[model samples]
Target chain A: MRALSGKVAIVGVAESDQIGRVPDKPAIMLHAEAARSALAEAGLTKDDVDGLFTAGISTTELGEYLGIQPKVTDNTSVGGSSFVIHVGHAATAIATGRCQVALVTHGESGRSRVGMPPRVTPPDSLRGQFEAPFGLPQPVGAYALACSRHMYEFGTTKEQLAEIAVATRKWAMLNPKAYLRDPITIEDVLNSRPICWPFNLLDCCLVTDAGGAFVMTSLERARDLRQHPIVVLGFGESHTHAMISQMPSYTSFAARQSGKVAFEMAGVTHDEIDLAMIYDSFTYTVLLSLEELGFCGKGEGGAFVSGQRTAPGGAFPMNTNGGGLSYTHPGMYGVFAVIEAVRQLRHDYLDQGIRQVPDASIALVHGTGGVLSSAGTAILARY
Target chain B: MSGYKKPLPKPDPVTAPFWESLKKHAMKIQRCNDTGKFFFYPRGLSPFTLSDNISWESVSGRGVVHAFTIVYQNRDPAFAEDVPYVVAIVELEEGVRLMSNLVGVEPDPGHVWIGMPVEIVYDDVTEEITLPRFRPVRAT
Candidate 1:
């Protein structure tokens, strides 16, 4: 179970110099800027990177922009969680000596639309044929469908969902770089305009332009790097169905499969996790993921997250960098989640006046992608 | 059908029969010949057995709304006019589910509920294309 555990460590992590609507920086430029920054932080040059991983953008494009020739490349674009899944892949490559140093990156101009190509789904595709014809505004509609079912089955209420947005915003206020820093309340979320039934506009993540990158190397080499190594103790990924309609169950997620593998490999229990960075594509994403990740019993997430349990000064500190809800969410937000986890574990923000989880030694980062179709869970530790 | 801006399904060979059956106002689902299990969103091979032992069979279009959402914002030019529409996933009595739109009822919280009985209704939006939607199964 611990084959790759502690064998690899994330040596450096950084976000693009500019995020949250940089109209001038194209998507590829964000990738380049983040890659450069992360490499520099690791005390390594682009030449030392033997593996390149990216999503939404191709490895070829990223490598050319960074002028690095990687011996191995992975463009596993499962959706937003693609970056988190890449960390698992990078760990495997490093463990097998397929590559010594792996660089995982993400860049998306989700809001500014700079250098972003037009998105087109062929009419003959599965989504085009089965799901797209009903005028369902994707993503939100898809997530709302699951939320509706959760409410029906588990009595999850708008109030319970609002608690998530409220808690996430609290964290956003503590970070200077967050896109929406103003505090929000449960009432504020419930009163926000409805985009899809059961999903108010406030419950959704921000649409912004951002890029993030991180470097991974063998644990032995990581100890010599510039930063404290956040060891990859366990990692697992799973995919069920791409189309939301085909999701095995509306109340549960594929994360159940992924999280089980990760926790078992890491040999850690829920009580030992010091912090969590769960994907917040929507409020329900967090609620359901908590349940599926075994943080709480099934159908109990609403009650579990009530009273801002995940907010600052609460029992469980999560998404301290604000998360996709208030932080920068380029088309995919997984890389940023990993970056925040590393910072907290390394105590990088201790003097920055930001709220880093005190003495956070173990962290659980879970990423969801493609309408909850894919999940990737990673357990990281500072020891 | 002029100015019909909504998105349309483009059927391939494997899914053409499902679309063709809708054109005839008779919905057909794929069933595994070996397992005798019906599946929606037709495919050539059985998902259970991964074999081509599959057959198309007609079934009662009666179902229930398993879940639904009233979409208020969709920026697609094809669907802009249909804002505040009801998009749902209906589970058929045969135990298969598919995505559709609810019609003949208001797209409001007061109207739609999970497990509400529904039946399929075909809409011939174009001369060659037909969409299968759903509506409440009225009490007899």
Candidate 2:
């Protein structure tokens, strides 16, 4: 797995409507707004983007709205990890001169929107008549089952899981864009009303009506751009299916394969990663990714995340911009992870005291989609 | 107000067997004839071999609990009354893990140990359907 190192760089990243219930806006609008914001951030206009990549939003629809005729377009929707996976394709497109600039964006009004299509249930074609009639309905309950298994197998206490929520809140306090900035404790997470067992309300991520986007360009084009170029060092992706039952292993994510591929491509180990922005749709997800990504040995993730090690100014500062848990989780959370990584590398948000890893050179961003069904891993660095 | 009713899941093509078999007080799994592999949530073909050589086979429903959790909260609104229910992943003698409710015991997280022996019991939910649940097997 050769890394796509130094071939492409994320020149700009931006988001739209971080908080509040926004039901009136359609999904495509969020995508367009985020795309415009990223272009503005990069000092480039919509006319400059030649390649358009998006997930969970219609590529042609977004392109039509942006008024750009893209030479290369990808709409690979592998759930939340789709955006991260597109980075690899974007890199390859840029490396071969298929396009000068590629923009990947995602947006959703999951909380406020209505008339959205129900999740796909295989083996039966009827609408809401197949799998939903059975026990597995929403993703929250399905993920809760996995969380319960983690607690049962490794003796992972609720407090240990709550540590993730508590730490993310500390970062969210600094981020004004965050939805839930109120300070919380482990007891608060434990005592919150249980949506599903082992997972109280606070254990889950915030449902946001937001959109995120990032602009990528070839190394040559990035050198001439306005800001310090954060190179796309490596990228990899893997997907299984939407159904929870189909997942090969409940505890270990498919991302382990992609993480290995990405790390191998970057020519770096877990120790070389100065910062990480692993998706935190649920607390168990982060814990599982830690084990799968080789950050710690299997069954040691519970012990690894202890003592606020992932908190601000801790051993490994992760999800520094509050992540999907405390920040915004408008449908797909993959693009937001990339946004945080690029921001941290560029030292753009330092005035807010969010930059903990000073001179941070290497960073990893990972994304999960479906019910832990698909995963994408990427490594970014300041060269 | 409507009278209290246990909201049992409606049987569909995939789960019709598990529900229908409960009417006969039996536990079964869809086993592939060619490869002799077993699967849950019944399907038309074997997942591994993708062969249409699959049929329903009855088992003793005797197995060990691979993993168990005492859920203090219920996700379904109908099961609100049954708070703190025990759910376990039972590994059948045929070597497949299935998710089902554990009954005939107290909901103690510590008491439900992994790899503990367990057996099936069919609880009649409807005239046409019976739900297959599990309970701890008494040590001889």
User: Per-candidate DockQ versus the true complex?
Assistant: 0.89, 0.25
Candidate 1 displacement at residue A46 in angstroms: 0.3
- For model 1, name the residue pairs that clash: none
Name the top TM-score candidate. Answer: 1
Off by over 4 Å in 1: A352-354
For candidate 2, list the clashing residue pairs, or say none: A80-A369
Model 1 residue A89 lDDT score: 95
Whole-model Cα lDDT per candidate?
A: 0.92, 0.79
Q: Give me the runs in candidate 2 sitting further than 4 Å from their true place.
A: A1-3, A118-137, A354-356, B1-23, B53-55, B68-88, B105-113, B123-129, B138-140
**Residue-level error in angstroms, candidate 1, position A235:** 0.4
lDDT of 1 by residue, A1-383 (tens): 68888899999998999999899999888888899999999998899999999999789988888888898999999998899999899999999999999999888899999999898778889999998788787788999999999999999999999999999999999888999999888989989998999999998999999999999999999988899999999989999999999998998888998899999999999999999999999999999999999999999999999999999888999888999999888778999999999999999878855387888999999999999899999999995
